[model samples]
Target chain A: GESVGLHLPTLSVQEGDNSIINCAYSNSASDYFIWYKQESGKGPQFIIDIRSNMDKRQGQRVTVLLNKTVKHLSLQIAATQPGDSAVYFCAENWSGGSNYKLTFGKGTLLTVNP
Target chain B: DVKVTQSSRYLVKRTGEKVFLECVQDMDHENMFWYRQDPGLGLRLIYFSYDVKMKEKGDIPEGYSVSREKKERFSLILESASTNQTSMYLCASSSSTDTQYFGPGTRLTVL
Candidate 1:
């Protein structure tokens, strides 16, 4: 079965440092990808998304990079802050063959130190 | 802003009890989804409705059912709640773009 997964379960970074979260997807037919941020006791919030046609997309302090060749995706956050500590998940969406579902990765817990 | 609201922020139910989780979206979107988030399972879709009265079973929809009688509201029903059903329920709505807007979520505990 095809699935999406994260490279790491947890990541710790300093307040001023940059943080990167990695994801690997097995489905080659997936076209759209999204990044979500979930805080404690809250639902996942949409951060940024990228289509398969493009390799990278940027929003605010966040950037999403996609590599179709390696079936890999990454989310980069610049100038990490304490408020940015949360769990991040990568989701892949396939539009082919009556498939409009989004497959989500297990997620990576990000901790920003003061 | 697209606002999706769930009926409860937290719920407690006993085993074998019937559970209902409600979600409403103010954006009048045509797509609504119900998902459960667990510790290491990420988010698993229980069900989704693309339009009024049209429902589709998701990846994990064995013990769950959905009803979408109206355009703005979608409901998830658990026939017989069990201890394994304890999880965080999330509701989301989207349009043709497929960018979902999620609600605050409801934490359910079945004891």
Candidate 2:
């Protein structure tokens, strides 16, 4: 019954603009959440992560926000560039009982236009 | 730098043939995982190993098997490759349950 899903399947953004990607998760027991970017012909790369105890975490040009009450997570990219075009995925770490596994979402395709 | 490397970037095999996909990590991680990436389905876990000689069935592990004979190396085996098995296979390693470093996935095509 544990699943993660994105609000949109495709997002088209102009270069140098900000982009916000949203995700909703079903499992409240999930303790950790991560965002990953996968470019064409490449593997998924870790962008950022936030723990259940933390509400927000920031990285270079990227921010991850976690809202435990609504079971929502979001990734914001500032000044989005052409290189930022990729499929983004949100994963949750299920730490219930003795199980430790990372479950991935369906992913969102982000296209940056010049 | 933490590095995870797969044996091949791309592979092509015929149906009913046994396929072996190898992965090795240099970070001395205790956890290694194998996942299949498909369109719209995202990354589905096929198998995982917590430590040497230990294995666990992930969300989808029907047509695949794994071997973790060493700490740094993990292998995924396809007993009889099928057309439906043609998908990108990704290998990842993590020291803890938090962050997982992924290797450039192998695009496997079963002809």
Candidate 3:
């Protein structure tokens, strides 16, 4: 079946350091992959997304890399700050048509120590 | 900005009781979805609607049903709330793009 998984469940990093979170997806037919940030007591917010055809995509302070060969995906956060502490989720767009139904992985909790 | 709002942030219901989880979006998006977030299971899609009065069963829709009589409002119903169904329910809305905006999840506890 189609599923998305993460390499780590929790990650701790010092402020100003870089953070890397890894994910693996089983569905090769997924058209797009997205990263979301869920703060405490809040909903998951869209951070960035990359199409399946692309190797990488970048946002303001974050980057998403996609490797189709190994079915691996990763998110990198630069200058990790206290405000960046949240549970991060990676999702795959399984429904390719007008509907964007996604399969989300078990989130990775990121804690930044100041 | 696309704003998806859920009716409740937390709910408590007894077993065998019917529960209604309501969601509304202000973006006028054509697609709305309901998902349950469990501890290690991640977010599992329960149901989704593409248009008013039209719905589709998602990955996990056995104990749940949905209604979309209005374009902006989507509701998830639990026929008989069970102990295993205690989880965070999230609602989301999306346009033609692949991105989806999520609402603050409803943490429902079934006792």
What TM-scores does chain A show, candidate by candidate in order?
0.97, 0.96, 0.95
Candidate 2 TM-score, C-alpha based: 0.97
**Model 3: runs farther than 4 Å from truth?**
A94-98
Off by over 4 Å in 2: A97-99
What is the docking quality class of candidate 3? Answer: medium
lDDT of each: 0.94, 0.94, 0.92
Candidate 2 lDDT over residue span A38-77, tens digit each: 9999989999999999999999999999999999999999
Q: Residue B30 deviation, candidate 3, in Å?
A: 1.0
Which stretches of model 1 miss by more than 4 angstroms?
A: none
lDDT of 3 by residue, B5-78 (tens): 99999999999999999999999899999988887787888999989999999989999999999999999999
Q: Model 1 over residues A1-114: C-alpha lDDT tens digits? A: 889999999999999899999999999999999999999999889999999999999999999999999999999999999999999999998878343678899999999999
TM per candidate comes to 0.97, 0.97, 0.94
Clashing pairs in 1: none
Per prediction, fnat is: 0.65, 0.74, 0.94
lDDT (Cα, tens digit) per residue for candidate 3, span A42-93: 7899999999879999999999999999999999999999999999999988
lDDT of 2 at B45: 94
Interface RMSD of each: 1.3, 1.5, 1.2
Candidate 2, DockQ score (0 to 1) = 0.74
Residue-wise lDDT of candidate 2 within B2-110, one digit each (tens)?
8999999999999999999999999999999999999878899999999999999998999999999999999999999999999999999998655888999999999
